[model samples]
Target: MLKKQFKTTRVFRFKRFARKSYSVFNSLHKTVTIGVLSGCALISAHATTVEPAERVYTQTSTDSIPPTELDEVVVTASKVDLPLNLAAKQVTVISRQEIERAPVRSIEDLLNYVAGVDILQRGPHGVQADISLRGGSFDQTAILLNGVNLTNPHTGHYSFDIPINLSDIERIEIVQGPSSLVFGASAFSGGVNIITRKDPESNGFAKLEGGMYGLFGAEARGAYKTENSLHSLSAGYKHSDGYIANSDYNIVNLLWQSRFDINGSNLDVMAGLNDKKQGANTFYSAAHPNQFDDTQGIFASIRGETGGRLKFIPHIYWSRHYDEFQLYRDGTPDIPATYKGHNYHRSDVFGMNLNMQYASRWGITSFGGEFRNEGIMSNVLGKPMDDTIGKYTKSDSRTNISYFLEHNFIFNRFTLSVGGLLNYNTAVVDKFNLYPALNASYRPSKSLKLYASWNKATRMPTFTDLYYTTSTHTGNSNLEAETSEAFETGLKYIHPVIKGSIAAFYMKGRNMIDWVKTSSDALWESRNHTKINTKGLDATLGLDLKEWFGANQPFHSFSMGFMVLDQNMVESGLISNYVLNPLHYKFTAALHHDVLKNLSLSWNFRWQEREGSYVQYVDSQPGERVDFTPFSLLDVKASYRFPHVDLFVNANNIFNTTHVDFGNIPQPGFWLSGGASIRF
Candidate 1:
């Protein structure tokens, strides 16, 4: 219930500041009342208690709370804001009703049940998606939206190709490991945060969806409240016409959020706009069936926040992208100068973030700081190529600074935390970096917890990895700055009919930024020599069984999820034996039942497997080939509920399989969908 109304307003402001510090320490004498009774026994021993099946399913446990249940997540990987089981790392809370019951559209379908994630989809709906975590690379997994920093000043090659459409998410907190210490240094191979959807106080909603291969969509959200203020607005639109052969798409989004309250201090504002019209297959094959290319983009963002325990946030942004292309060699179009070309990209971002927390009598301390500035520009138009031409503009600027500190020692059943992070970066022409990190945590009980961390991160080599095209083999202006150091450990668990987590990780990278193919032609360039070693293990499991089938009103539920991953790069000349480096295994199962009682039942099953071959490019004659194969997939869904209205159905790759999550393009066979939702 609004997280127990924000935990009873932070325990009534910590019991009115421990009764005004024990009445000014008993009028300045009486030995300061034993330091105000040890700050009132550490705020009543960090109060938090509410069992009895969450106080008897306070407000219905809808389907046993397993829609990727995230019991109120808010973990900044220990820069404070705890919860997610006292965050000390290993946080995974993907929700928005599990992105609408896995209707995940993009962001690799919302990290397919995240557990050491690794996704690489080659085609279908505006193709191009390469996401990796624990197996880092997809530009070393460090993406954020809502915390802004969608990385890609061009050529970090991770632009899941537009469409963040997941119906304006309201959650997605994945802090697996090496968060580059409080988000910096490009996460080094971990950290994904995107929590949007705020400003809701009253009640308002809107939704519309269309399906099938050429899916269509619409959404509208509203919220308003007074007594101080709170407002919300959301908008969405989507289009697609792809299932293969040069995919297609169009997307638009607009969101606004606001909050205001005085006397307890609170202020928030957020704005957004994103527009895109995309269709590019990077020239698909089977003899290029009318291969076509196009791209258009526009973006905007503004944010501000300030409330309580030392807080402040500021942000600004702007973006523009446009591209027009045609290159038909076999599919005819009679090469009119290779069908003409044009490209333009622009960007600007400004930032500020700060937060603080403090609690006394020997524990709880947090600190923060952040500053950023970035600008980019790229422009190109028409002919001029024998090897390459000109008019390609470039402007680069960068600035970022960070500082952090943390502490959270609580005894009596464990609770210890320590942290550090300091980063400073500047670029306008390379060289100016300083990074650092350290972490720890341990909680012997309270549903178990244990953690560890070590960090050092950096990634800076974009501008098309130093000035775009310089033919014969792309540009590489003496790149350097892809550094890393990672170390990790994990374990988490909670109970009440089952909740879970399991983890293990290791990462080591150094100047490891690859893409090198040069022996006179085959053109591919971007380097930092290379050295990468990653290890992984992730686990998640859930079950409720409707409290042992004794259900009358706790809905009914069943769940299962599993994942495995292994990645490598032992650094033995030229990016050691690449395999697109992602050893994978995934499985999922879910069942929610009611059958009839307002009528609702849902079933979802997914399985994915791959064990080798994922290297996209590599050939200095020492190999002479490229690869991508080994695949398997499946998906399905169903829903229903009525009182106002709610009905749904879905099936994807349901037996009409035709797999290939990447390479050899083919996926999106057997597609069916139905939708309905109306509530007032």
Candidate 2:
């Protein structure tokens, strides 16, 4: 049998009235806050602290090596441009070369190769991917685009599906460990910052690509540069019929960035907008796969920078997201025989972020602050007022503010940095949340380095966990925020040919939140358990063998990387009904070679194995069962490039492995996709 849920006649009218009133109030409040904050920040800059940002590498090169020897790779790790080798933390860079050489179709595909990270996929394409760092859950991590936070409001468990394509990205930065001290909420796990490409040519370029699975895409960019100013604009769109049932997606994005020199200082402004629509597959069902889940959203951000001794960066953004999915019975097919039920949710967020830094000969210091107002509306089961068996209208809103301070001190052969964060959260229906953290790093020698950090992070309860009420799932209003105290230490070694690093970490969490069946009732309720811990080690060794490929022709380059991760839960409780523990190992290799005078070939290979654990679930006998299984996957890609066009092909699950990756969900085996991009 099927069921349907809808908004009540009077409630619909009330919603509109409330929205109008709220908008007016929001505008007035925002204007006043912005003005006051800007004034206070300007005044504070006079006595600003000094802090150096982490460094990143956009290209491959050395600092002292003249331009004749190599090209410099500049990064914003320390908030200032610096060489990659001098970065304070473990930094991973995914260059444009790497993007073009892989079969990556989504953000998950682009990040799956990184060590100490886990990507849980519901299937291929934009369906669903739970990205975790160091055993942290999806809600623990923070996702950013162009340095702006993009965490979804409906559920912290999901992030804004990457708006741009592989071709649109210039590079990706993955900083592991607790970064909330630097980036604010949702950075409890780690942080992923995606930087898009700027216009590359004065004459402009247009690109078109097509491939299997109903995939096709295009991008256009142009730029103008003069003595005092440079202006650029770019736009791109992509669409595809995903690899799974009811999985289809489309995305469009536009970006504008400009820089102007005023007197001795400089000004930078960047603005972007994105709209995406993707399927969710069968999120809550194993009986039927065709229930067709859908997600649609729009996001925009604008920021300005002042290039001064005391640098000032301020930005603001807005996001509107709406998602809906259908529910069906086990015996039913993809097409619903009757109206089972539906879940509809909408979320909107308005936020402001500001950062400042003071630099001198000695070192640099930095401080930043953030404020956000978030609102939510949903048509889940059981809210305030409704009468459809188990249907209701849900709504909640809240605001949060956070601030951070840090300093970087540089010496002859070593560098040290320390930082801390303070957060204040106010919700309309619950108690306030306060979070704090501290981190530091040290370099013992050029070839050897050590790092350590500690943090107190909090993960707020999800919307579904706190407000949902249905036949299959129940919600608890009385829930506390989950908190964690983490500590980590690591070592790094850099050699001329072989470079690698190792890190070990331990994190203990209390009031861990999960759902468990009630003893008296047949419904599930949210509860907190004490003492849940995660401990693991991460290691990576990549050997560069350009000399082995050829003496000095710029003919070839090869590198290989390997990683392993183990995660477990130490606390015992019935509410902990997920994959209790997971073990994973992965290896990847890349080879780039010149095929002809103006042609090059790049080949990439990746293999991964995952050891799964038990998930609490009711079986056919209505008894709980434990599942222990193993799954593996292999992926490969080859690319050939010329002056006008670049040809590429990717093969996923090359071995055609038929074993199930998702417990009850069936997935296609051995899929292929190929495409080409033409540029002028």
Candidate 3:
């Protein structure tokens, strides 16, 4: 009888959502027609002002022998900088050129195509998303902006609330595998660092865009540069009525960055803010459909460095986050006015770091220490109290101090690094802990390199994981810290026309954390599970078509990547909630071609398959477990460049495939967007 009811519920849910999605798509079709017409009119008006330039390519002579070349990329995964081929860890770098060419609206969209990264997006244009790496949970991945850690202590879900506009980024660096030795905690899987543009060049751009679902946005950036000083400012705003009800959003971002050379020291300062308000249809609970959220974040950092054989860098950073959540847009009469079933949370983090590096004939040595404090004030997520003041219930704070040391030995053709970190946390039962790492790289030839690494890392529970409580969910403050040991090895090849890498990794986790429920009707409870094991493989291949075919080919570039992951639970009698989110396999491919002297076309494709199924509960009914079938998506972009302006159009999910990423939340299809940018 229960099985029959579950099946009936699943069918009804699928049909209901599917019908709504089709309606949204039909509305988008009309919007797309109007947007295209407007875009064409704007382009025609500007067509007489500028002339298109011929496409140019640098040609290399095949008749002459090329000189030996070392890798030009400087990797920052280690505390110190090293060449890409010489760095022991696996690193992927996305340059500004690539970012500009991709048909993506957000950083999360760009990362979704990477080999080992997993992006679970709940909304469009990075309104909300969760990022994971190598089968690790979202909380295990550390996020950094210009080397400043930005992992939120409140929840990892907000890690994507970055302030800098995509246009302001110079490059993105992804370091895969454990990195606790350098970054301390919450880097059990790896780290992602967004490096902002700091080149001393006087340049800027203004952009305007419109798309389906009432999406519209404007962005502007300006930079002033001199021989010894540089300053940059950027601002952007985006609004969308959404493809469906209760999914609309508006976002605003502002940033300022500056650098100055004072005597012999280099000083840098940065400040940014991001504000967002959105309707959350099924973001948290499906039972309450009229959910809404408003969030704001402010971040600032100052850093200075002095150079010598013995160099020193000192930096300090501060971040504040405010969040307000409403389960229902309208209040219920039964609920108390004092509580109102609304949640308000504020979190602040401040930290200071001092790092010293010494370079000798033998090798390079690096040492660093950090002190950080995190505090939170909440209305409904902490301890309950009788004397409530203005909807305030609880406040909590914690401090952490950490120190690390690393030494790199550079041989004629090999490099080896050893590092360790000691950390103390005031909130943890075991206040003191140590993590260590060892990595090695061997370069037999300029075109080929091999690397291997082993590391141990740990992560502390977030405030939401330790103290959050609600009618449908609960947290446990007694949960222990999660730890993991990871091992990885890879081979890389680089040539004039071809570049690629393949890596395999395994991780063993102890005291793994997860949210679980005993039955469909039970409330979700956070706990530290006994054990988990994960293994994965990542591979990427790229080809410069023009170079590969002797510079005469019409096509410019082609690239593809593939990843496979497997995870297992070693403990008995345990049910997992988030642990089963990893994909079984993922594949991505892209191609670019020049269609005319000033016109180009780019296309990207992705295929993904999840490991298993997820069970979603409907009010009072036995939930049905449904599997996310294999799905494929395709995106295409076309751009025309003129003397002073560039115009582009992007079509995403061109095939309009119906798919669900999480639960019954239907993803948008057949999205069309167009934009123009003017540079000075």
Candidate 4:
């Protein structure tokens, strides 16, 4: 309820994007808008009745309309504020209720149930995981916190290294497609934004959890609110002896957030810090069973919106990630000195943006520019350094500039939006490139809506991909930036008893990057392929059993989802590492029911078929080539309600089905955990 009331995007208008240099960028921005609109031409469609220009632009946005059954949930679509039904792209909203009731312990696990999103986990309990959307690799997706970019510059493996506990989240918004125009080049496949809680009343909670394998965890959160401001603080710690030999982990998280209202506008500030010491046995190479890593990260951002008839937003964000990865843990009696030391890295990212928008007789016009700097200092990840800093001797840095222009139009039952992005990266390209987008939606009735969108996005290789080198691996500094042109069309149906959406999409990628080698024994090198095309179908259906069966409803909710993807790449003899292999088929189902007056249960199940193979290890050596096989997983949770607390227990991988999500990494089986929440 607080999330629905004090939505940051709606109230503060601290939207994602904005530009500087009005006079210089204005002409070029308008020309791009004209070019895209002319190329798209208006087609037949229907939508909600357009409100009068003056009232619609000012009133519909400033005032909050109570959401109905979560169907009309407000979500940010392509950097524009729009309700779910009005959005042109496929967007998924995971509400606070869903997070509280779900049978998952971490944010990464909850996202695995979504239709188009993918979470490839090497270890559980927030140790490490790679997130992707649609059929793209983990590196192609952009992860944000509170609309701020916190993704790592060294590698996608650290993108999920967020510094906050799952209890600190309020809601999550996922846009499943290319959104580079707003989130930048990394959003080639999609983007996910985690919004933190903003409580209006004074409240707090403390939780404790424990399970098998010597697992133990504790967390606490508190929030205080004044008439014009709100502040919150949360901290947590978790440890596990692991389900297998050398798979243990220890993690600590701390988070702080605040909001202040000044005049008619508002300001929001948040920061987080987390530390991790993990046993990553066989995580990267199957030959090493004693692999270990230590990670420390900090992310902070401040955003403020202030304006009258025209809105202006100023934002500043920064992140620092430090990692020490050991192929073999200390004191392992290595064979050579080259293999005796650990790899150390430090990445820093700083960004700032200024945005302006206006609403008048014409549709809303928004324009903004961003300046970003990404730099890395490491022992083995960048160019050779002439001077040393601390223990790092190598370094690299790049500057990126991006300008955005977007407009939304409403005419009776038709809604349309056109936008374009201009970007320049000093590390990859010499000049700015144009990435254009067009989206439209039609609503023939209250229950059914049709939408279509076409978008383009590009991604530059990370520091790891550009300079990493070793005896068994090599990096190609000449690799070109990859690009994708995507088109999607979908229909959403919302009814009292049945609510669902189905979409079909296609993407054409050029100059795709992949780790390849001529044969199994050759060194792995990064290379760019000519073209790769992908097509997929994603659908989800939810049934409100309560509405159908009245008080005797068999279950409170039931949902099922299916996704199939096929990718065709240029035929070659290259042995691919990341790009070629992906999930070809995936299906998910969920059921939640009340067993008694105070007891409830939830069942979650999924089946996946992947298209790839890995060199299986035997007796500490690569023995057999094993192709990926289909696997199924089932998870269930039981909860009992009390006056001020809830008791819950969950079993993941209940069937103990052996499966492989990433190369040479064996997933846990039949794990159980329990916890209790106390509120005050």
Evaluate candidate 3 by giving its C-alpha RMSD to the native, one decimal: 16.6
Candidate 3 similarity to native, TM-score: 0.87
What tens-digit string does per-residue lDDT give for candidate 3 at 1-680? 54453343322211121122233334334333333322221100000000111111111122211112325455577867655666778899887878888888888888877867888777878788888888777888888888778889888888878887778787888888778776657787888888887654437889999999999989899989887888999999989999788789999999998877654445678899999998877777666666788999999877665444454566778899989988876543454455456788988988877666665545678887778888888886666655765666887788887888888876656889998888888987566788998999888987888999999998888889999778778999888888999999999998979999999999988888777776556788998878889998999999989997866657999999999998886643334456656788999999999888889989999999876555665762447765679899999999999988999999999999887666656678899999999988
* lDDT on C-alpha atoms for all candidate structures: 0.54, 0.58, 0.75, 0.76
Worst 10 residues of 1 by lDDT: 43-52
Residue 5 lDDT, candidate 2, scale 0-100: 14
Q: Candidate 3, which ten residues in sequence have the lowest lDDT sum?
A: 43-52
The window of 10 residues in a row where model 2 has the poorest summed lDDT is 43-52
Question: Candidate 1 lDDT (Cα, whole model)?
Answer: 0.54
For residues 592-661, what per-residue lDDT tens digits would candidate 2 score against the true structure?
6665664565555656665543333333113343453555666766667677777767777778876444
Please list the Cα RMSD from the true structure of every candidate, rounded to 1 decimal place. 23.2, 12.2, 16.6, 7.3
- In terms of lDDT, the best-performing candidate is 4
List ranges where model 2 is wrong by over 4 Å.
1-83, 202-207, 224-237, 242-244, 251-279, 328-341, 381-392, 428-438, 515-526, 547-555, 571-581, 591-628, 659-661
What digit string (tens of lDDT, one per residue) describes model 1 on residues 234-280?
77777778765456667676666665554333444555665655444
- Location of the lowest summed lDDT over 10 successive residues in candidate 4: 44-53
**How well is each residue in 1-680 modelled by candidate 4, as lDDT tens digits?**
44544343343232211212123344334434332322321210000000001101112332222222223354666555555655666678887777888877778899888767778888888899988787787889888887777778899999888877777777788888788875776788888888777655427989999998988999999998888888999999999998887899999999988877664355677899989999998888777888898999998876665434355556777899999999888766655666647899999998877555655334556677778889999999898899999889999999878888887664434567898888889986577899998989887876788999999999989898899888778998888888999999999898879989999999998888888777667788888889989899989999989998886754898999999999886844566777877788899999989999879999999998877676677867766666789988999999999999999998889889988788678889888899999988
> How much lDDT does candidate 3 score?
0.75
- At residue 158, candidate 3 shows an lDDT of 89
Residue 460 lDDT in candidate 4: 86
Cα TM-score of candidate 4 = 0.90
Tell me the TM-score of each prediction against the true structure. Answer: 0.30, 0.79, 0.87, 0.90
